[model samples]
Target chain A: MTSASPILIIGSMAFDDLELPTGSAHNVVGGSATYSAFAASVFAPVRVVAVVGDDFPEEMLGTMRGRGIDVDGVERASGKTFRWAGRYDTDLIHRTTLDTQLNVFASFNPKLPELYRDTPFVLLGNNHPALQLDVLEQTRAPLFVVADTMNFWISGEPQILASMLRRIDTLVVNDEEARQLSGIYNIRRAARDILTRGPRRVIIKRGEHGALLFDEDGIFAAPGFPLEDVIDPTGAGDSFAGGLLGYLSNQQQISALSLRRAMLHATATASFCVEAVGTQRIATITREDVAQRVDQIRSLYEFGASTM
Target chain B: MTSASPILIIGSMAFDDLELPTGSAHNVVGGSATYSAFAASVFAPVRVVAVVGDDFPEEMLGTMRGRGIDVDGVERASGKTFRWAGRYDTDLIHRTTLDTQLNVFASFNPKLPELYRDTPFVLLGNNHPALQLDVLEQTRAPLFVVADTMNFWISGEPQILASMLRRIDTLVVNDEEARQLSGIYNIRRAARDILTRGPRRVIIKRGEHGALLFDEDGIFAAPGFPLEDVIDPTGAGDSFAGGLLGYLSNQQQISALSLRRAMLHATATASFCVEAVGTQRIATITREDVAQRVDQIRSLYEFGASTM
Candidate 1:
């Protein structure tokens, strides 16, 4: 294995109040940055840059630090931390957002620390496009940049998102967000439209169906690992992005082969995320566990080539 | 190439009135046997056993005969043909059934001819459980038997469906039917529950999402061919089953590898079915066309084995 580079993650870190059919949990640690950091840390060092309130626990930061995640870039301000409350249906596929308290995250302005300015890999977690662009501007000639966005930012910050799209090398979004962003129902056409807008590569994450990677080379689909039960699905998409970039950071160079393999790793990590609430499963799992799951996913899609 | 064996298909032949998002078509020739016969005819000889009314067009049967699909088993009764009218949602994912006139189909009792009884491969199309069982009883020592079912029969004829399931080698149903029949939301679990019931193999079809095959060998997933537009999805499932059994009949022996490769052909054929209102595309396409689409579908899921 090559030496792994640290991935800079910029987004929010907060507490989630989840009402799942299996049960409910309050003050669960979650958020784009939090989930991404834990997932990425499994394969490489992670640098988190986000703001939390003084009410946030220092022990969580210590836990991350123990896992080789740098928390020096994390800003702790005066106020309650960002808290989101959501309720999931029995199917666990759809959820309704019951509340959102931005708290210190409302004024989140990600500032790259001096030591983090030269990080070669950056993961702009799902956030406002302007803020993502701000981090991109601060980076000094990064080797790769992957930005994740959602419907809220696509509609609210279209112009800025467009600008961010041009700057980022890869754009990741869920299936619904891809359609909403491109105004196209067909995912293939949507990815084609997004390619013209800016990003050279688009990864559309479909919850249980699996994920598709569209690049100049061609399309590669990774089958989602079949889980008997899902405890939570709060940060599956972010965890996928985290694992993708995390695995890519260890590669000698990013190529079509590398990207496709990275997607398999991403799929494996995301599968573990949904097995437990928040990042419980991802945080506790080892690299070997991920590799094993990767093999399972590969077998799921593997078949002999058609000779007819 | 191995010499192909003829496949005996039993189901209904009827007239369909479709209201699609793109347009509308009235008096369209369709039904389970019709679609399956056309799709399977791409690879092997297809013997169709179905019931139609005197109002059915004689030229339609002539068309099937031209394609190497035997229509001697098709019964022409003295009544109007079964007619169905449905309107699709704008997304084309859901539809509202406007009308259903059972007509002659209500009395469909499949009685395979003596010649068809010797056919080694049989495809039991979606219909009442009793009718499906009636066809199964008529078949001699068959090398393989594949059956398709729907929700109406599962809910209405549980005992009969259970009996039929034990007699078939393979059972094919869409994702919804799998869940409804097994009473499990998770598809993997649903398939597991189905495996205990009787059939050695269970194929869960997820329309645009592709299809999954589960058996004693484990599981194999075939990605759905990405289409820019789907004209109509009326007979895609039947076409899928038809192509699957068709390709299987041409194989020297049905093993894990053959079954997996057959799924690719099935996916390719089903992709073409949705390109037109009824079976237009599948009926017109040559074997080479289906092979080319199979190659494309294989690429959609092909990737390097993970070394990380």
Candidate 2:
């Protein structure tokens, strides 16, 4: 795959304070746009469009610069970076947000830089659907437009969510969000309904269970790798979205083959993401580690039939 | 492949009352034994063993007899069969048990006949753990044995379930139950934990997400057919287990290949189980339908490898 430059990510950029069973991690680098940019930058140049506050460490920007992540559109203002304090109950599968301080991120808007406007792929991470729609309007038409959303949007702004789907090419959401958005309990049906809205493809991320890719013709199932343990699942989804759109943008192809491969790759990346609290697990990981884990993830679910 | 006589299941035979957003179907034929027998009968000659009251329509038994399912084990007694009423609030995925009357099933115990004793495979439906254990003890050592349990057993009587797992060859539990039983969130690890306790294999059924099979060296992931609308999810899991064990028993080879194939076969059967309310959909399904759907499932996950 050739290197894709200026891969733009329009979403949240802030800090996540997480409490996990193992231990508590504070001021860990988080936010959909931040983790995604950090993750995708490993494969190609990443341009982020998000807002942070004065408290957003300049050292983090230095770290992004070290990895070649461009934060040209990451506006810094006189406010605290969005701070979210969440606790992963004993059941690490689900978490309850104790508090969400949207601070600088609350009224923020995404502004695509001239260089990022025509980026081959634009990834809209979990945010308000209206903002996602606004981001799509600003981005230059490219190879594909993929958007991710949360349950809040599904239940609160479904009309906006449905209408916004028409502007993007691929939709990524958790399994619950998909079911809630489509009013279909069967995931395949929910994806089919979402596809009807606009995006030709849908990816349902089933946190620990793995994910499914539903396109026009068929569905593919991938099993999650057994993470020795998940320290904190805070930013796993954004990392997955980052890895998915990153692979798609880098490959510059949207065939079934590419999507399946991307699903595996994205899942593999997320597997590493959960190994530690926040995005620290994936920050230092190498592409070779990802490649190796991808093979393992595929083999985890590999089966062959014999005429015998 | 030759047709084989299925292990007759005799237990609660009842119609479920369910309210769904898609559409409502009343008095849909359901109950553990009913779903189990219908699922097993599709692949082989099945015999049901249970007692129903006057309210229990004789035609339902006739329908089983018409399908080559033997109702000789069905004992018509007094009051009513076990009736469960549930409502699907939002997604048909989760149903709140509105009401459950033990009815005639409260004190029923299954006694296998000489013909039934010799059967190679037997599935102890989800009932009191002691009752299920009793049925297992009564049946002669068949080729294989599996028992299903609910959260009530897992939480109410852990020791009995654990000991029961030791006596049986297989145990089918839902995702949450699997976690509760094993005290682990990582399914792969949970499977390993269950395998060590008693059963040679552990099957974790993740409702619409499909199922997972874990043994010593390998793990297989099966994604459920994404359905557009789930009318009523009641009895889907029981039907899935019936088909899984039914297929494995008939195929009669407990190799890795057979187990994996059986998982897929069970999943395909469950897909049909959800089309209508309760047993009505599962009862009408034919083997050809199952085999074809299984093939479709295989193809959806199939991939051509250019290099390995």
Candidate 3:
């Protein structure tokens, strides 16, 4: 294994109720933090900062611990855990949220461990922009900070999201959110507009089509690894973020080359995340499995080019 | 200019009325043959075989001839030209066909001229499967054959489409049509299933997202060049088809490397197609213009990869 760096991730850790066309599962161990931490652990040591409740499973935490994830920053609250219930469309790309019970998560506050504050990489997963700001304030001067946001926050709390955008090195958003955030239909133009807002780079995730990385250097397009069967698409974006930041943390320096390589790892990890329900597929995969998939994904874009 | 070879194209030749959010245009020169012939002329000598009415503009035919496109195979019937009207959605991806008057086009019987019978490359543009078969039968011995089909024929006439599929070297269809034709939602699986039906390769076009080439050698993905403004997407697919086969005709042989290079040209040409209302941008560009765009698009996927 390569020299692994530690990545600090701050987001929700909760139980999920998922309804797929094939079947349904309740009380599935899920959340932005749960998926991100597991995916990140494949490449680097992960420090998760989130709030779970007394009812949350101890075995899942132990599984994460066995995978090299540090849970010292996880707060064990007295009340029930955060829970989300959603039903996926036949396409698996669209989902309708049936319920969101904040429970203990409603009043949760993130206080990072001292060791996490000094971590070189930080992933601020989807949450209220104000809460993301609170976590950002707790961290020391990290080398890189990547944040993910959705349409809910963009419309509900724009001012806070705008403030949070200014503090991060990269902003990862799905294509629709990018359009909603920028108010521009043209993706390249929308990304250019977002760059002026604050983030140095914007990664527009087009779930199945692929992902595009827009920064001052130019645009980098990475094709999503085409799959025969995508059993579940939950946590794909977060997994992509975790894998990207995780791989970058281990790099000696972040260049265009390194960023491109990180995208390869990110795409591979997300492909595995959708292979089965919840995080079952990604949680069990090793670093070698990710590396193999990375090779295969890279082949999708390989052509005989003498120069760029 | 690189020892250009001849490419025969068979499809519609007509006028179109296009409505866009920017504005609307009437009597714009368009059709599968018109777009493909113009795009093909950049890298090859194009011979167009289609039926146009007496009302068709001679000036447009002259314009095509000026670009190395031979219109001798164009048969002018005694009637109004085929006319199609469509309104594009604000997104510009979805369009509602307002009207389609297949005047002389309804009687389009593509018969290759004696000189064109031996053309080395052939692009059987979108038409009825039986017409495509007629064009294929007329060709003496072509080095390569690439055909484009749409949903209209896939569902309207499946048996004939299947027969045409077996004789072609490659089949190009948009993502939706690919899914419908293969009865599979997963694109990779759809393309795999398509290969079993007959064609040696399948190229699935995903409009603004990109294109995927699936063959026995494996998959090759070419990203769509992100444009700041897309005035009209009419004829973009046919333009891509023409550019690919045109570029391939000049190559010594069809191999993985040649196919990849052809896709670069195809993508570059299609990007230009959407820059204007009809075929204005593609019609006005030079060979060097295409090469420059090809370089720019190649940079989208370029990384420091030493090997596949």
Candidate 4:
């Protein structure tokens, strides 16, 4: 990994065969690690600690390295890479999973390299909480830690999820997952309930409604910029995590302002992700472009009073 | 009338008796007519065209008069006023409806006064489509027409609602209402669906997530300013309409800039409305205070970016 502050992302990096409106696009290099690493690297040089297989194309690896992403910890083994196929209807919100091949992902175990041990930022993508906790155990005193979980983990291993929640600095979850975890229909109350578990901060993303940031002080919201064309929403959550952690790692301090700015950047990144299928949209995001688009969003909110 | 502008409001004026942890308040004068007329009168003279009854309370009538709301067209017969009673759990999002009293509101008809027929602007509250159409029939070519509808109308009287949708220039609906109306689960599609019906513009308010504006050209979104304590959500929508139309009428321009600015003001006013139960928090609202809070909201979405 480069000498810059390392953000070790322990997640998936593989192929996403999408069955989109215009039919199928095969074996696009996707996975949370791919999306998040690109996003985080945009702000800080990142180390991806995940497993891939021989079938995983070399072009994808070359792409990450060219972007200044350190994939040395991305262990390459035998067999095939993880693959996911999904379709979006008119709802786009309610996507149906067509197929999931957990190839090399089945026996995946992350082991950070010696040079990456000092990595200060860590993002644990949705996985078995035991696996998440295992990664947490291996990492050094991380400057900031954020873990994402889903209903499967919450239902399958409640106790393990609870342990993982207690150890992290923040938990990023969808609104439904938040409700299922909190047992309350209202997301606001779900946020309050999640706070009781030990994490100082909680961010509940409302799909297209944008995302919410809730800490000890209160809740601040960042709305998703309205896009008429959002072809795919697959890696949106990972993209958000990348943007959030990327901004945080790029900052000098971790105050409320820093966190809030991070949230905004993450939100803007997610906005672009839904514009086209897969990672093609966010693949070329630059800080200048993100900032200018953020200005447009901010302009949508500016107002002046009438003295008359 | 103080002559700032004549405001016409075609909406419901009902009695909401809510049971909160703090205590229970009974038969309070609430609804779009009550809140919009009161909220708008802060900037303009208002005429409320809503149905009520003898049980609608003389004290409430005096209160409207106190606020300079012309309740001359508030048809008062010898029936009951619409009464809604809800009980909130610790998590305030899902409040169980303990009671719903559709009293005189069942056969309500909006009859505008002679002076109100010439009012420059109309703020339609969440009401029956036919009633809104009836009020629209009486008014002349208004400079600005703002409308609000609920899920009930979108589902039950869709045919009638679609017909009414053709008349208004702008629509203000909560996110669920937009989804229900559009029949598309994806938010951008939902906005497109509503725009298809006829209104030149649409604003989908996502409660605490802020609001999204959709028009023919494209779309924009504004984030909600976070608030610490949200005691009551009643009248927040109406207050939003009041703030939005109040600014629109005073500025005398319905450009995208003004509409967005009005949106922020409306969002800010709604923020204050949720601070206390019912309309208590909005009673003391002033334009000056609104300006300062609005600046705070503007600063929220501001972070200039340089080329990286």
Query: What tens digits encode model 3's per-residue C-alpha lDDT throughout B1-308?
Result: 55878999998987999999999999999999999999999888899999999899899999999999999999999998999999999999999999999998887777789999999888998889999998899888788899998889999999999999999999999989999999998888999999999999999999988788998888888888889989999999999999998888867578887887788889898889999988899898888989999888888876656322
TM-score of chain A of each: 0.97, 0.95, 0.97, 0.95
- Candidate 3 stretches greater than 4 Å from native: A304-308, B304-308
- Could you give candidate 3's per-residue lDDT for residues A18-59 as a string of tens digits? 998879988988999999999999989999999999999999
* Shift of residue B263 alpha carbon in model 2, Å: 0.4
Q: What TM-score does each of the candidates earn?
A: 0.97, 0.90, 0.97, 0.80
For model 1, give the interface RMSD: 3.3
Rank order (by TM-score, best first) = 1, 3, 2, 4
Query: What is candidate 4's lDDT per residue for A246-296, written digit by digit as tens?
Result: 888888456677787788788887778877777787777888877877665
Better of 1 and 2 by TM-score: 1
DockQ each: 0.62, 0.36, 0.61, 0.27
> Model 1, B305: alpha-carbon shift in Å?
12
List where candidate 1 sits over 4 angstroms from the true fold: A304-308, B304-308
Q: How much lDDT does each candidate structure score?
A: 0.90, 0.80, 0.90, 0.80
Model 1, A204-258: lDDT tens digits are: 9999887999999889888877788788999998899999999999774798889
iRMSD per prediction, in order: 3.3, 3.2, 3.2, 5.7
